[model samples]
Structures are given as C-alpha cells and as structure tokens.
Target chain A: MWMIDLRGIIPAATVVGCILLIWTLAVIPMNAHLAADMAARGDVVVTPHSPQDRKAMTGVTIAVKNPVIIAMTYSLDRPRLPSPHQVAVEMHNTIFTVAPTSRRSLVHHAWVTLSATLLGFVIGTTLGVLLAVGIVYNRTMDKSVMPWAITSQTIPILALAPMIIVMLGAIGIQGLLPKSIISAYLSFFPVVVGMVKGLRSPDAMQLDLLRTYNANAPQGFWKLRLPASMPYLFTSLKIGISAALVGAIVGELPTGARAGFGARMLVGDQYGQPMVTWAALFGAAITAALLVGLISFIERRTLNRMGMGAA
Target chain B: MTPATITARNLDLTFETNDGPVHALKDVSLDINKGDFVSFIGPSGCGKTTFLRCIAGLEQPTSGDISVNGMTPDAARMARAYGYVFQAAGLYPWRTIGGNIRLPLEIMGFSKAEMADRVAHVMDLVDLNGFEKKFPWQLSGGMQQRASIARALAFDADILLMDEPFGALDEIVRDHLNEQLLKLWARTEKTIGFVTHSIPEAVYLSTKIVVMSPRPGRITDIIESPLPRDRPLNIRDSAEFINIAHRVRDGLRSGHVDD
Candidate 1:
C-alpha cells in the first residue's frame, strides 16, 4: 500500500513541481518592467548599481546575469504575475495569521463559499436524482427531459451567472441563496446523467428475476435500482462537488460580494494585487481537491461495504 | 393423478424488434405435473427458455392459454407460486447469500424471524448452510448458482422454473450440481421446469424430457423417463439411462431435421 501510494504521489508531485518552477521562472520576466520602474522611483533599491547599469542589460541576459533584478521581481508589491512564494505567503497570512472570523482572512471567505457550495450540492443532488428516477421510469421524461437537461448545460455559466443573480436579487433574494442556486444549476447535470445510467445498469436477467418475485416499481427501485445506482451516484457526486465549488466561486464574481473567494479575487483585481487573487484561487483549488477526496473516501468505504470492492 | 402444476396449450410468443417480428415460440404445449422434474432440451434459440419464462410469467404468450396451479400465469406470479432462476445465477453482487435468499421473503412481507428460518432451510437444502455470509463474487460459479436456487426456494414456492441454470459450469461441477439439484427436487417436491441442452442431464434428472427445435421454436417430442425417483450418481452408467439418453438424442436430431 505504501509503495502504491508513493507511486501515485511521485507523478503528482512532479507535475506540481514543474508548474511551480515554470510560474517562478516566468514571473521574473513578466514583472521586469515594473521592477525596473520601482528601482527608478527609489521606493525599492534592488541593487547598489545605478539604474543606467540595469538599463544597459537587455531581456534574457538581464534576467540571467542580474540576480538583484530577479530578486526584485519576486518581492514586488503590485506584480503582473505573482511569484509562487508570494502567493503562498499571502495565502498563509490570510488563512492563518488572522482570526478565522475576520473578513480579510481566506479561511473566513472559504467558509462563506463552502456553505453555499454544500447547500447547492444537496439541492442539486436531490433534483438530479429525482429527474433521473423520473427519466428511467417514464418514457416521456426520458425522451423530453433528457434532451433539455443536455441542452441546459450548453449555455455558458458565465453568461447565465449575472442574469440569475440579478433576477434573484430583483425578488429581494441575495447573497448565499443566489450563489447556491447557481451551484445547484451547475452540479445537477452530472448527477442526472450518472444516475440515469446507473439506475438502468441492471441487465434484463436481473430485471426478470425481480419480475418473477412480482416486485413492484417502488420495491425494484429501493432494492435493485437504488443500490445499483450507488457507485455511479458517488462518482457523479465527486464531479458535482467540484462543479459546485466552481459555481460558488463564479456566483461570487457577478454579485460584487463582500465575502468568499470570488469576492477576494475581485478585490485583488481592482486593487492590482495579483498575490491576493492567486492566493484565493489556490484556496478554491485546495477546497475542491479536499471535497473530491472526502467523497472518494466515502465512496471507497460504502462500495467496499456493499461488496463492490473499491469500485 | 397429480394435478397439472403448469399447463400451456398452443402457446406462441413473437418478439417485435426493429428489424422484424422474431418468432421465439410457436405452438409450444406442455403439462407439468405437481412434484415433477421436467427438463426441456434443445439447441440455442430453441425457445425452451421462452417456454420456462412463460411458465414463470416472465414472458407473455402472444396467443393461446397458459396456466400455473389452475390460475393464469400472471395471477400465479402475483401469488408468488413460482420462483424463476435465470441462465446466469443473477445473484445481486451487493447482497450476501443470506440477503439474496431473504429478498423474495422480504418482498412477500414475511416476518423477520420467518424470513431467517426460511433462508436457513433453503440454504441447508442447497448444501450452502455456512456460506450464508459470503457474497456471490466470493463463491465459486456453481456455489453462486446454488445460492440463486436457495434464493428461489426461500419463499417456498410450489414451482421452480430454471432456465439453463448450470449451462455455464464445467462438466465436473455440472454433474455434481445436477446430482445436488435432483436431491433438492426430491426433498422439496416442488414442480420444476428446467431448460437444458444436454441429453444425459435431461435423462438423469427429469421425470419428463422435452426435445425442442428452433427457427420458430416448437416441441418435437416429450419423453416420459422410466428412471426411478431415487437416482444415484452411478445411475448414469446404467443401460436404462443410456437408452433414455439415446432416445433424447434421437429426438433432438429429428428436431434439427424438421427445422
């Protein structure tokens, strides 16, 4: 088990390391102009050498030969692209340095987003399951509702997010509710598709066995369809939770909200502090990974208990 | 004379597919007496399974009359008068042997204690007593099939409809299971309608052998076995059994010729 875990971790760590290396390397060139200006203004003195010496250097050679200028790019107050360490430090400060209840803390913002995500996930799962059941049992629903459900996903979430927030706000509903509604909208599709396939997974022979017992629709659903759908449902829930997090973050974007990761991103963008936005983005990513991990853990335990053996 | 547990008169079943209407069963007729072990032997697509399905009310005949225990097949199904076993074990993988056996009893609203008792009784009949806790995947294919049979017998139905239940097992397993099944039939005395393609198996287990032909499946011959009720494994070596097996083979050949 340890070997298997190490095998999985090695590849993942390599990919993350590569991404960080590239990001760190790119930041120096991307923020070179800003760093040069900061040096000229004398607000930041990167080196003892005059601005004229730095001006003499050009492009790749300047980045390679001048360690001070490269160092300057790593510590800029308002960088075009924040260095990996800058984002990590900002994330650490916002997440751990302050009280969790503080508006400025990423922990508090994540909590606000997480609450909306959880609510939306529950609502979406319920709706998706119900629709799937209806589609499986009723031919008309399968024919009509399935097409609409597929088409509904074709509409871009970015285009729909503001409209939903505005319309819901017009009805005097605001904040978490609108964001949750959007989350529900985004997350439910996977559940519906997965559930429909799962519910119908039992073959004709199994169905015939149930028929021989004279099992009714409700009995069939409860005993056979529902249990059969479990693996599929869990798979979809993993996808759904991640989508719900995305929805919660995007839902925050249109509202100009005062809390949540999306709000933090907006404030950072407006204030020209890329570190704040990158920190919030990382926080959302970590939250999504955690949610998916939690679902997978539950799935393993449930499927294993049901004799499905880690599927 | 024992009353007919299952009676089908000129039954016909045609499945409507996109390609065309496929005739699965045509003019198939048989009478299964109470406590009788009847085996339907035929090639693939011979509608022997369709006939068994008709008896179990899993399939509806396009025309003609079929009855189980003097009532319509559908009514008998609703009354839980029969248990149908499929070609495959069809045991739900998620359920343990005990759980699978208890499924029918649960559906029929048997009390918890009663369900447990019935499950235990059937498991013992199938010689799967200690295997109650094992899931279908944990068991051998033959064992899984036995558990499926145990599941069917749990509700104490008067008739057991089996569609090639041992078709997938190896020769040794099939022979062993065939003997066990004969013992089960003797102990339970439930009228059984079994579908198979093996002539020796038909001769060894059945009170009656039904030879059928395909391409619009029709019964070619129905041979009443002269074998004794109590059959031992060595009975397959007897002249009487060989003679009966030969007759079944001839009937099967005639079925093919007619086709």
Candidate 2:
C-alpha cells in the first residue's frame, strides 16, 4: 500500500491551483502599463498615444480601454510583474538548456545554495542536539543555557548575517563557511527547542522503568530518550532545513557571492530582469520543498520501522 | 520456608507541599517473601503505589526502614533486583514487541545471543510469540500490557512489582489477564508485588493481601488467602473466595472509618 493517499493530493493541489488563478489574474493589471506603451508604439488606437501618459492612468483603465493590449501584458520582456508562464520558460531554459556546471544554469545556482543548506543543517542539528542534551541532563545548563538559546533566536538573522559574514571574512574564512555559519545559526534554534522537548518526552513511569533495571544514564538515553526523540527530531529537521535554505539564500544576497540562488536574485534585480529573479525565487522554493520532502520521507520510514509511526 | 524478599518497618513519607506536609505514607510496614504473590490494595492516595515505588527505590521515605533482598531499596534497585510494571503498559512506541521485551536484557549488557534467546522466551511466555516485529500500537491494550510484563520478566530479576497493570482494561480483558498473570506467577515463581484498588483482583492473585487506606496512608489488615495454589476462574464465585473478599472489604471499611 502506498503511504500517502492519492486523495490527500487534492487539498494541497487545489490550494496551489487557486493561488495560480489569483496570480494569473493579477498579472494583467500589473503589466498593463508596459502593454499600453507597446500598444501605442504599434499605433493600435489608444486613448493616450504618449507612453508617459499611460503610467498616470490606472492599469485597469488602460486594460479596459485597449482590450487588444491585454494579451500584450502577458508577454512583456521585463514587465513590472513577469507572467507565470514567462518565469516557467525562464526556469526551464536556465535549468535545462545549459550544462549543470554553467554559472547561468538555475540548477547550478540551486546546488550551490543547497550545499550550504545541507552542510549548515547537519551542523546545526548536531549542535542543537548536544545543547538539548546538556539542557536536559544538567540543571545548571538548563537554567543558564536555555535562556541564552531563547535570547539568541530573538536577534533577527538578517541583522546578524552581515556581521557574521564580515567577521568570518576578516578572519580569512570566506565563501561557504560564512554562509554555512549563517545557515547553521538560523537552523539551530528550532532543533534545540524541538529536541529538548523530544528528549524529555519520556514520562516519569517510563524513566522509572529504566531505573528499575538499574539502567545508567547512557542506557536510559539510548534505550528510551533517544528513540523517543525521533519524531521530534524529524519535525525540527523539516523546520531547520527550510530555515537553512533561507539562510543560505540570504547569505548569498549581501555578500556578493558569485554562484548561488541569492546572488542570481540580486544580479537579476540589479539588471532589471524580473524573469531571472523570479526563476531564482522559484528555484529556491523548489529546493526547500524537496529538502523538506526528503526529511518527511525518511521520517516515515524510520518511525514506521521503529514502531513510532502513529506518534 | 520462603525467605523474606522485601521488608518494611515504620515507613513514613511526607511531602512538604505548599498546602502543608502531605503524609503520603505513615507508619506503613509489610513483609513479602520469596515466591509469594502479594497485593497492595487501597483507595487513592493510600501510598500503595508509593510503598511499591519505595521498594523499587523510585521514592524516598523520610523516616522509614525498607529493604529489598537484605539490601537498601536504592541498593537493590541499582543491583537490578526487581522489575516494575506501571499503571499503564508504558511500552516504548518506537520498539517492536520483541524489542520492548528485550530492553532490560539489553540494558544489563547480555550477550546478543542471550538477548535474542530471552526475548524469544519471554515473548512466548506472554503469548506474544508471533508479534516479535509488531509495533506497540499494532497490539491491543491487553497485548501491550502483556508485552510490558514480558519486558519486566526478560532479565533474571526475581521480584516483579506491578502497579495496577490491568486497571485500564474492561472486565473481560482484565479477567483474562488476571488468569494469565496467576499462571505466569506460578510458572516463574518470582516474588510479585502487585498494587490494585480492586478487591477481587487483590483476592484472586495474591498469596497475601495487604489492605490499606488513605488520609496519611497506613496498613489496616494483612490477610493470607486460604485459597489453594491451583485456582480456576470459577474459584472467585466459591464461598471460600467470597469469605476472604468480604473480610478484605471489612478491613477497607474499618480503615476508612479510622480516618
């Protein structure tokens, strides 16, 4: 039997379809000025022949007056809002037309971003779990470290990212390490919170059962606490991965990194190519979705085999 | 004559809560012998489970003398002298029935072969033979409880401490488990300390029944069952069983009046 129900796809798919509908409808108005300018250049009868005058009128008025220009809105080269189809074509071309090693390829940029995300996620999860263990086992650490962990997350990653990048650069550590550090910083908080909850998930009776066996702390951890935390671990991993991806993309943006989704987005915005920027945005989204999907798949397999699938 | 496997004298436990010092156990004393099936039956807050926990070294009595196998309760616990079953089955949801049964063995560092052997044996003992790979959620409540019992029995600990193991089940399931429990007790011949609020449950399984009551929990009466070792389900309806059960009820009522 398949783990996920085919019917389960309908709800999420319907929501995506609705979003696309709304987005596609919004496109006409958003691109109508450019369409109006093109319509005037073609000498298609227009209320205002001047390109500058079209900008003063509402897009709805422009679109309503020149119905022929409506179709033109969906095809502008670099309109204020690129059509979804245009972004899709850009994404497909950038992803498939060039070799994966090419800098222009969306896949290459996505891979660069993903490498940092995966690296940071691994480090963050390990660090988070270690901190969680310390918090759970030692009262001193619980009281002292937990407050700091909570407070650390309050410092917005955007504000901290530049400082981290510049500090690491000043120390002769550049490129992937700085980006990974930012990603790790973003990812660790959820893992710490989720893992602490997971490790302490076992109740008094469960702990007492271990006590009766004269099971030492290590035995209790391995036999009870660790296995008990698997569900929580997976939950945090999914959240951490998305955060890591965001961190990597953010790290790429202000640092002038030459080869990641954030850099592509930055370059596209600067060059006034909305299609390139939109493609990079979609690429980052797809990467995050895939990474989260992989974690969920692993979670199901592990929890099912471990008999904690229902949990 | 069976050796006294567990002994308690003047077991006083107080909890200094915000309300006041709640006397959880007061002047509670009892003796349980090797191979004896003893039941601690009482109302809620009667410290029956607390006393059991004291024996398992899960609780500390402020002023008390308690021993398990001639050692301190904590020492006996660290020595792995007992296995305890909680009110709930409390099986780890992540482990298979077989793996849950093997937990104690694994904890004690048994050889891999020995672990597998003990797991198989206990699973068979609990009639969970084919459920070696089945998860805890896949099993019914009774089966999960059985798996927990098997888990407690996996190692060589001679004392089995159970706190309301069958209390959650319906009458039919509880009856069946109680029967199976007696057989398990007879077969293993381990010293068993069972806690229950049910009078019939206390009367049916225990060789000695300790009747207790609350408001500062204390023992009222200790009744030794006149029923024979080999008893069937129909034995509960017999006059002898009813006679013992009536005395237990009287003991309980008298303790209630004492408060």
- RMSD after CA superposition, every candidate: 2.6, 1.8
Least accurate 10 contiguous residues by lDDT in model 2 chain B: B91-100
lDDT of 1: 0.89
Give the alpha carbon lDDT tens digit for every residue of A1-311 in model 2: 46778699999999999999998888889999888877777878887777678878888988888899889999999888988899999998998899999988998998899999889988998999999999999999999998998899899888989999999899899988889988998899999999999999999888888888888899989888888888899999999999999999989988988999999999999999999999999999988899899999999998877766776
Q: How high is the CA lDDT of each candidate model?
A: 0.89, 0.90
Clash pairs, model 1 backbone: none
Candidate 2 Cα outliers beyond 4 Å, as residue runs: A1-4, A50-53, B1-3
Docking level for model 2 = high
Candidate 1 steric clashes: 0
